[model samples]
Target: MIKHNIGLTSAEIGGLWEAFFQETMSVCLLKYFLHHIKDEEIKIVLTKALDFSHLNIKKIKEIYSKENIPLPDGFSEKDIDLSAPPLFNEPFALSYVYIMSRMGMINYAFITANIARSDILSFFTNALAQVTELYTDATTMMLSKGIYDRPPKISYPKKIEYIQKKSYISGFIGQKRTLNAVELTEIFFNIERNYFSILFCLGLIQVVKDKEIKNFIKDGKRISEKQINFFNEILQKEDFLGIISVSMEVTDSTISPFSDKLVMSLFHFLNSIDITLIGHALSMSMRADLSTFYSKVIGEILLYAESGFSIMVNRGWLEKPPQATNRKNLESR
Candidate 1:
């Protein structure tokens, strides 16, 4: 979705808004996806939706450039607070997707209005229409799956006050809690499960294509194995399940709608995602259990993240963020 807030020019705020939305929404999208989706075909469709949103991040920047707007570095992927529990559970995932789709529509409509002179606006408008359809389909799918959760309605007049007071606590404090060994096991497997599920779907990203996704998945699958192994060791004697049996089970359809350059960019993005996943897993593991098991797991994931970082650099996809002030000097070499 696009933004229409009357604060700044497309150049000044476009990248920031895009980054802000994509970075935050992407994590939530991934979480709800892991909870609700099981079919490979369905996962593919969702992955395509994710690709659209991700690519729009770039398009927003390009649109800003076209409008002579100076895009601000508003935030990074870290801006999103995914550790907070989702607003709803699995039953609400589809509705959440729908809500996000509507948000995308609003965003794109605003972009179209602001940049009526740009060709990309036309493309975004087309995208907005399709996203509406995707939301419709996703909602229907959720209904068919018997898992659609709608926004809550007011049941009591005092509920507003209750929310005003407690929403802060619940949003910040109540959402995330340390899981027991059993809960911890579920959490790790759940992330692993979604990892492949999204990869299977990303095979359809029009810009990035399947081979890039497959290669990145190849690297990711091994890291996930390592992370699970580390966790299983942590859960020793607890009869906790780690990376037991899993499968991608993707269909044979292989066609890409994106350019190769974009595909490479996305693969790089996935690599960053892999490294971050390990960091989060390790961080949570440490917080939940200060035992040797957790420490060892962190060490293992640290190595894995470093390895992915090496690969990311080797692929020439290491995006020098703002902190890398000396990169210009290094690049000149």
Candidate 2:
């Protein structure tokens, strides 16, 4: 093990802090899924995911103890109901793991890159590898089950070509050029994620009793639908079919399987991810129309996320992460 005498940097603390909550939340979700899951293949994958989450939580706690940092009170057994009937079908559970593993891979890789402390770096490096394997596992299972939604395929170019006309980038007026491969890939992934988001909101809205929370989730579902229509319309104009995952489906169970706080926090997390993804799509888009669309939707998502954040704060659900000491306040005192 590499030893570091220096303390954790703010970035490292922030990364670990975020990871702790994420993993704890995962533990609750995976346990609930395990209770209702019948498919052995998907069960095995979820079990592995739960084990990884447990290991991550354990490691994070160790690091926190060594640093004399207080542990975060993330989601736990109280947040989930194992006795409640399945709120989502088996296929949806598998798809959830697949999508979440992909997100975990992205997050772990990003955190690992930003970490400088050797021990923390090693921890996240291992985490990235574990989540990558989980992603591969979930993907393989989806492919074998014929549930994986493949992106649209385009004909290969005959020769290396360069854009010579300014109209190539022009999308606001005249005939807009078809989406490039990069842009198509981004839009395709975003649509898949939004589909999951819609299903998530639909499931929660069915069981959550709080009127305000239910309305918030209803709005989230509507926003996802609008975003999906926008992306699908763009694809339709190009004669390419819009991507939709047929494997995902929510059950009619009205029993609340999770606390309102957990559901709201999960929604906030997903919305934040959506904003990050849309921002990236905006940067990669060369066409003004695509960029403009992404920017517009990003603003909508930010507003929705902010509302959810306020709810979490008001309900005492949001955990405060490590922060710099208030030196100015010390002088004032």
Candidate 3:
């Protein structure tokens, strides 16, 4: 390990703190999956995933100890029940790991870019590399199994042509142009993500015991289904079929494998990711209709996320992050 005399900056602290919680939550979920997974190949992959989460937690704890920062009380064994019946089938477990690894890569890259300290930077850089390898492994396994949902293919243009008319960007008015490659790619990716979100919500909804929490998850499922239909309709209008994974399956198990706190926290984490992706899609989209749709759904998602936050706060489950000192109160004293 590289030794650094310099203390961590706010960005480094924030990133590490958030990562601690994320990895701990992942450890709980991955352990449950490992207990139920039967496929030897997938079992190996999940074991690797569990090991990575444990390693991350260990490193973060060391850093916190060196800095004299109290460790966050992240998810623990109490939050998960290993003996509960399997909530998802084998294929869905593999797919979940694949998608989560992709998300992890994005998150690690962002954190790595923001940190200046050499030690913290090295940690995130190594994390990015590990998650990238995991992503590749999952993807290769999916492809070999013929379960990968490939994006739609477009014919190669014979000649390079620039947009000569303003109508090329317009979609709500007369003579709307067919979806461009970039636009189609965003739509397809969003649809793919929502499909997974629907499955996740479906599995959780069946086992969640709290009435309010169950209703919240049910609302999330409905939103995902609506968004999928919206994106699919856009593709259908252009004579392109939407991509859906046939391997995604949720079991009929009603046994709760996770605490209500963990479930709510997971939903909040995923909602933040969904909002970020939709904002990126909005930036890439040029058509009025697509842009309008993204903007509207962002508001809807934000509202749902806020409701979840309120629920967590009311139940005293939301952990507050470190904040600046209250100078005003000190001055008054």
Best of the candidates, lDDT = 3
Q: Could you tell me how far off, in angstroms, the CA of residue 270 lies in candidate 2 after the best superposition?
A: 1.0
C-alpha lDDT score of every prediction, in listed order? 0.48, 0.89, 0.89
Sorted by TM-score (best first), the order is 2, 3, 1
Q: Give each model's clash number.
A: 11, 0, 0
Q: 198-221 in candidate 2: lDDT tens per residue?
A: 888888888999998999999999
Q: Where does the lowest 10-residue lDDT sum fall in candidate 1?
A: 151-160
Write down the lDDT that model 3 would get.
Answer: 0.89
Every model: Cα RMSD to truth: 13.3, 1.6, 1.9
Query: TM-scores of all models?
Result: 0.39, 0.97, 0.96
Model 1 earns a TM-score of: 0.39
- TM-score of structure candidate 3: 0.96
Model 2 is weakest, by summed lDDT over 10 consecutive residues, at 166-175
Off by over 4 Å in 3: 1-4
